[model samples]
Target: MGERGVQVGGRAVLPGALRPWLGGIAGLGAVVLFGLGVLFAGDSRPGVVDLRVWAVVNGAAPPWLYVAQAMDFLGEPVGAPLLVGATVVGCLLLRRPRAAVLVVLGVGVTVGVAKVLKSLVGRTIHGDNLSFPSGHTAFFTSFALVVALLVAGWLRVGRTVGVPLVLASTLLAAAVMGWAQVVLGAHYPTDVVGGWCTAVAVVPVVAWGVDRVADGRR
Candidate 1:
């Protein structure tokens, strides 16, 4: 079997190929939860959950605060391009053009969707800054998701292992970014959750689309 699994009708068919769709279903459910969060956070006031998380995640020591600041920078203009560009180059070096494309689309589209949702939801923090979905959280999570999918493909891992790996990687990345955003007071906890869900809901679908289009062309 190849890195992408067996090719059938020009499509890469992985072991337990149907299993990844389960993640898609779970992602949709998370999106629903995020929608509810938006409704509650639209007033720009932190809810009970947000406050609870804030109390725990906020107020770091100078050292940890610096770490969080560095994490924050990774999602900013200067850091984002450098990080993503390096990943894209790495994918290409590995001769995985599809993975390279995914790295771009997954992160770009996830962040774009978050921005759109911010305007639509009108959830704000620290004055008028829109914060419905934390774009920083979404960016890192989506990037992780893409990397996880690429790893699964390259290793030819089945759904049993692949799904958990992808979910875990995404969650880990989201948590780190979410913590940083909360610590920095850039977003409410609910905003971070929404951002995480946005990446979950978006990346898999984009992957599927990329596969379909690539397969069709083949």
Candidate 2:
């Protein structure tokens, strides 16, 4: 290769190398923001918020408080099995089995980090229930949004219309999940926002990995 060809290729390689580092920084930012929110929110908002009002407005639970707490303990709204099903559907439809695997890994990593962070840096809800960045919100948003991105690009949606539509719908779903997180007292608004920022960081990187895996298989 000529000198110019070598120089251009070297620079292109540098940009590609930086991409993963940038992604890690974004994930770290999510943790920091979530920590800050928890620190500043101390003694300001109720940790669990207003349960009766939420129940009345959302028709969310049984008349019994124990029953509601029981449901929360069981993770009624965003059940693990349901989330797994959605992830599976998205991965299969997009022909990216590896993306599903990556998602599981991402979620596992996030949960571990969240638990550790919650104990070390953030707030204690109950005796041991850590309540900083909501794991449920992060997982759902990350999984849903990243899957949307993968499907959009995998379909080769043109910039003119299809791609934008995919994004719009993805944002809508993310929004609903965020709202649910807050209303259900699983998270504060900022916790959900931080989770989104985290998702923006991890999802794309994971999707890229999945895409490459799928492409290689083909």
Candidate 3:
């Protein structure tokens, strides 16, 4: 099945067949869980309570809110420009042009599918919907995950060099973006979960498909 996802030290195994099928499975689980939360969050009051809990934990005023909203400092498409460029460069550098193209497709699918899920379920966003499975969160997460995983394998350096540092920082950025989504009230918790699920599933599955094609061509 040519399972090759997020390899670490040449020994890392994908959690599944590293195929589209597995990605679909992961995605479905995420959707089901989100639906359950929507259906049985007790009631609107309960939902509000849960949100308030997060608000308190995030502090009376989340710094991310200011950071996200300050358009003059940082406009929309926060990561889009960087992501497009990075995906292209990463593909070229890795000699995985097909994988790179597939990643773009995968990200597109994530956004499209998220919209379908939101509309089909008619799940009203506590924050906003058209907002189910936060596109911004998913988009940035996919960006980080793709860059991290793609570059991770090729990063060979002297043993003394900190190989894991870059990957860790990328992952940390994704985490921060997810936190920002929550703090900014751009998405609810479930929306963030859905966003993450959409990304991991799509990227690995798409990459797996790309690998098959590239290997065949070779």
Which is the leading candidate under TM-score?
Answer: 1
* Residues 36-81 of candidate 2: C-alpha lDDT, one tens digit per residue: 6656443334434434335544534444444445434433345755
* Residue pairs clashing, model 3: none
**lDDT scores of the candidates, listed in order:** 0.78, 0.51, 0.53
- TM-score of model 1 vs. true structure: 0.89
Residue pairs with colliding backbones in model 1 are: none
Winner on TM-score (1 vs 2): 1
Q: What lDDT score goes with residue 110 in model 3?
A: 59
On lDDT, the stronger of 1 and 3 is 1
| Residue 89 CA displacement from its true place in model 1, Å | 0.6
Ranked by TM-score from best down, the candidates are 1, 3, 2
Global CA lDDT computed for model 3: 0.53
Q: Model 2: which ten-residue window has the lowest total lDDT?
A: 5-14
Q: State the weakest 10-residue window (summed lDDT) of model 3.
A: 8-17
Off by over 4 Å in 1: 1-30
Candidate 1 vs candidate 3: the TM-score winner is 1
Off by over 4 Å in 3: 3-49, 57-64, 70-79, 93-95, 126-128, 156-174
Give lDDT for model 1: 0.78
